[model samples]
Target: MPKILPLFAKALTDSWRSTLGWAVGLTAACMLYLPLYPSIGGSAQMQDLINALPPEMTKALNYDQIASGPGYTQATMFGLLGFLLMSMASIGWGAAAVAGDEESGLLELTLAHSVTRAQVVLERALAMVVRIAFLSVLVFLVVLGLNGPSQLGIDVGHLTGAVLLFAALALFSGTAALFAGALTGRKMYAVAAGAAVAVLGYVFNAVGRQSPDVEWLLNLSPYHWAYGNSPVANGADWGAVAGLFGISAAFIVLGSLALRQRDVGV
Candidate 1:
């Protein structure tokens, strides 16, 4: 390992088992929901069931497009279940990157070495991204394999965009936790910060869909930014993708600055 990135290597090695578990969960979910789409996606009964849902419920659940292959995949796999799983994993990794380490007295030992604080922050963030990308790649491949059989008709390009957006959303929450962890050196606070961002973004997006009057709430929502316009059915909104990545980078900078100012393991 490079002298500057030993922490990064350690992060990945320590989390490999956890990452594998998450990948298994994602693969299982894909196998379960995606293969069933052919039977459930085209039925009159499914359409009637969806139509019976209230407008708010329809939009909030993202079930309005459930009849289509892309829509079904986005609602069940990428947007809902995948998003949930990735967010939790990312937050756990992010929080552990700093606060969890400090609380366990590992961070101070790393800092006592020659590696700078900034390197620790950036490399930790990079490790988190790598693990997330691994899971996302698995999701992409599994869905693509099932595409023909499930008759989803998903465009390869659009599906790529959706999966990337999903990863970015998870990064957003993860980086938020990282920032909080660096700022407070408290895992509980970091977890709450990460969870709060996801919860609030979800609520904001749901409310924003209620009416144009409050639709401005969507503008404030990272969830909307990630999933708006159905990136699975359509090409990704690159602007939103860039925005999420940019924010995550900012979290690294802010986190490094905060960690540098504080006393680790104090």
Candidate 2:
């Protein structure tokens, strides 16, 4: 068997286990709220809820009326943004896949074989891609299943867009793990940094929504572009999707280069 496959397989296994709860939580939350969507938080109901919500609560939730339609409401207002809370799951996965092995000195052992440093890094990144792809598939299915009745409801494009967006985020966080592995040589730090980036991005996105003047700051946060469901609610933003993939690619490439340049077990 190929060496990378084992690494990739292990990563996929671990990532699946790690994100299982998040997927469940996402599905459960959407399922639970979906029943209440009509009177509890659809277009007309959401309008009243928004009016009643305090400014701070509204700001935290990114409450926007455009995200109030049946299909879009659950995805945009609830499902799509769940990654903000679940990102730590990816972060933990990234950290364990990379720095955890390194910390155990398995990285040096693996490199002692036929694998080169670049191969190690590439395989690790590939593992992340596979892992995140699994998460994306789960999320898409769960969201689609929960909103199954939205025939003219849930926008397929919007749903696919949101999945791609989160995949990009997972890639971005996974890349940061490489940097954390190289710099700190510690899994904990790598995990924490990835989690922080994901969480902070959501916080910034919230801030941007609440205050238009500082909205420019939203550009810096991944959450700003993660709202593919937003475009579905109103009009999807092709630019946001492009920007997300573009930025995520940059981070992954830069992190790979950095990993290659560094000496392992340093």
Candidate 3:
């Protein structure tokens, strides 16, 4: 313990305000959507509205389960809206971790201290892990609080599974951004890479839902891997969670290598 990871504390301190903003946003999302379940998920008209939509549209959006409590919560917080929001936040943090600092010349200052390049990347990645884990816990608690009032019908076990899957999914994008940032030393590349994964993975999952012919896309889509077995209801496929964490670990390793190979670009 040689007082390593000076960057870890610095990163969290630097971004506390942004992290708080994310917290507010996440909690607000939980309150807004979960409360509406009693009105929307419980309504016959809501079902009518869903039925009125094209089957293809419904399938793509996972609207088939909007009437149920667990399904409603999944479609809202853990699946669609919150999913995109968390992914966006993850990408922002991940991009800023290395590429943003490099561009700002702050990385040079950090490097002037006694630290290896891998340590810089590792500390930043650890910061990301902490933040995402916090948000995931935030989601778990907020959703749990709403479960009784909003009638979400989420059990502790299944809810835990949902949040775990959601965390892994968001981290998947974040690590992609980290890898891209380290590889190119450009924040734009990091954002693009992360966005590509979120958007394309979502599309692949949607398409795979359309028919069995393309269902193989489900296997490759991170979105599907998280939600494919209906984690909210089925209590998560542990194998998928392990796969996501494994892949994220690989990205971190690759990012360290990439950063080490290149000039700091400061």
**What TM-scores do the predictions have?**
0.97, 0.82, 0.97
Higher lDDT: candidate 1 or 3? 1
- The digit string of per-residue lDDT tens for model 1 on 40-92 reads 86777988988988978988988888899999998888878888899999999
Task: Write down the RMSD of all candidates, one decimal each.
Answer: 1.2, 3.2, 1.3
Q: Could you give the candidate ranking by lDDT, starting with the highest?
A: 1, 3, 2
Candidate 2: the clashing residue pairs are 231-236
All candidates' lDDT scores? 0.92, 0.63, 0.89
Kindly report which residue pairs in candidate 3 clash with one another: none
At residue 164, candidate 3 shows an lDDT of: 90
Determine which window of 10 residues in candidate 3 has minimal summed lDDT: 1-10
What TM-score does candidate 3 get on C-alpha atoms? 0.97
Worst 10 residues of 1 by lDDT: 1-10
Give lDDT tens digits, candidate 3, residues 1-266: 76556789988889899889998999989888999999998799999999999988888888787888898888777888889889999999999999988988888877788888998899999999999999999999999999899877888999998899899999999999999999989999999999988988899988999998999998889999999877886789999999998899899889999999988874
Q: What TM value does model 2 have?
A: 0.82
- Report the Cα lDDT for candidate 3: 0.89
Q: Which stretches in model 1 have alpha-carbon errors above 4 Å?
A: 1-4
**Candidate 2 lDDT by residue in tens digits, 112-196:** 7876665566666777666667767876776677565533266767767656766776667666766676556688888777877
